[model samples]
Target: MKGRGQESFVSLPRFAARLYNALTHTQAIERQHREIARDLVARLARGRLLDIGTGPGRLLSLVHELNPELELFGLDISEAMVHLARKNLAGLNVNLQRGDIRSSGFPDDFFEMVTCTGSFYLWDGSEECLEEIFRILKRGHSAYLFETYQDFDESAVQKALKANLQQESLVRRLVTPRLLMSQLRMTYRTNEISDIIKRTAFADSYTLDPTSLGGPPAWLRIRSTKPAARA
Candidate 1:
């Protein structure tokens, strides 16, 4: 993230577009990333899905693999992201909303499936975000959370903190997922992300095997369900 190549264009308005271009433009690297996205989106297949932190709506296309009738929606805080997503998915019957997942304007039980990938770990509170996920999902709804887990060793994280990526810029040296999770005091093991869901409004939750996301990345994908009201 040093040179003006891809790092300089990320100035709020062009941030999302830059993010999308960086991932999609890389030929040798992008296919693996897309395949990983494909797997995560497919596993949470359900009607009326919502994508959180959907950077440029690339993964939203994966819904095509599921029942064609399935509906899709996405939310992102970046205007550039919104514009790109709208343009990229114009022909499809999908809804693209510009909003924050933490304070989403949607009503309760609005969707059957909710997905937040490649961006959930950037948020401030893991618990609060989980609550918001539960609130917006319908009874018996399922949510898929994709994020980075802090590793045990300190060197692995210290290396990512000094990057110049948008969220991981130099000014924010400790911006890597490892440092971010540690700063947030999130001590849950990778396996415990699911259990964290069950302790909330969701009644059941479980972890899937480490999915092959096809990138030089280590991401955690956890699925959970919101149960019907207790008697």
Candidate 2:
């Protein structure tokens, strides 16, 4: 079991692993998303908190720093990411694991809160993943899904462009347009994400909040819950 997990980690592309933090770190919008996620977890997370796609575990680390009493667990598919996350979260009692969200090995009703940020589009099995999340969450508790879309509102695109121009260095500023274009190519539409959510076990058990992260209008949040009693 451990070897299988480690194998996946070992196969992570070096550049992808290395570039993950740098790309997210310099962006104003990325920082806003991370802050919003951390705040959400701090306010609502109790008992065990599991953060999926916890690349470098940055957001989890921030949440732990703010609310030291909450237990933290992080799961990511990349070995290099887990390694960096371990180092980033060293001294904290965080359980960092390498795994896929569609088939996490945790027991049913285990986690009090679950969070996935900035990685939903990478998931190939969105329905399965949501089902897995629903299975693991304690009844009456919820999972938070935060994603940024490519096809954002016009106002959001303008705000993001202005923020990038102001905050990034001159060289980095020149790259913003290209990067944003690439992101748009890869991102899913808001309706596409919502449709995936509606198709899962969490159908009719979730709420969508667009632009709540206060950055790009492209940022959307979904709060999905497991019913207190199975019908």
Candidate 3:
């Protein structure tokens, strides 16, 4: 049997696509509604930005709108999803590439800022992954990670998915929420994730819920920095 570590890369790309066509064909559109009206753009002003797990690139579009001069690079695991993001965001000055954030090949101190939305919980190597992000980013560069906080256990869910993941496309998967939920081995609490980030070497790590923004339950944001002394 292959390991979860070996399979995480494969599962990530399919997660968004399958969730869309499988769970809800209009998932992207639904996400657009909540995000466009949300504090995501206000939190991520402009200039050099790295968008991790940039599913379909709606957040990219929003950031661009917030500031046209924003130089944005997007990375995701799904090639097909990248295509959709490219097509959906045509004529805009953005660089969207297919890559796993776990190994983004950009040089260190490259970006002024970084952001991930709806995908942080999917990461298998949390501390290591953040260290990589910290490595590539300039000191004091801000990062925003928005993910589900109220409904699941981050570890157990990923563990189960890493085991029985089907090798299929979104059109083929038609992945139901029930099917996905069943794979989850545990439930997650916000403080559980909060404690993980707070204990990391990264400073200023904190969680912001919907109450922090007067919004919905699935909303959560973490703001952090790479220690300037390391520079």
* Best-fitting candidate, scored by TM-score: 2
lDDT of 2 by residue, 1-231 (tens): 222133434478767777756665666755665677566765574688899989888778778766777888999887789888898889999999988887999999999898877766777677888999999999999898777676677675766677756867876666655665675667788788778888988988998777646455666777898989867
lDDT of 3 at 128: 67
**What ordering of candidates by lDDT runs from best to worst?**
2, 3, 1
Query: Candidate 1's error at 60, in angstroms?
Result: 0.5
Better of 1 and 2 by lDDT: 2
Model 2 has an lDDT value of 0.77
Clashing pairs in 1: none
Scored against the true structure, residue 203 in model 2 reaches a CA lDDT of 88
User: CA lDDT, every prediction?
Assistant: 0.61, 0.77, 0.62
Please tell me which predicted candidate would have the highest lDDT against the true structure: 2
Q: Could you give candidate 3's per-residue lDDT for residues 19-82 as a string of tens digits?
A: 5433433343344334642455555465578888776777788677767777888887777668
Residue 111 CA displacement from its true place in model 3, Å:
1.8
Put the candidates in TM-score order, highest first.
2, 3, 1
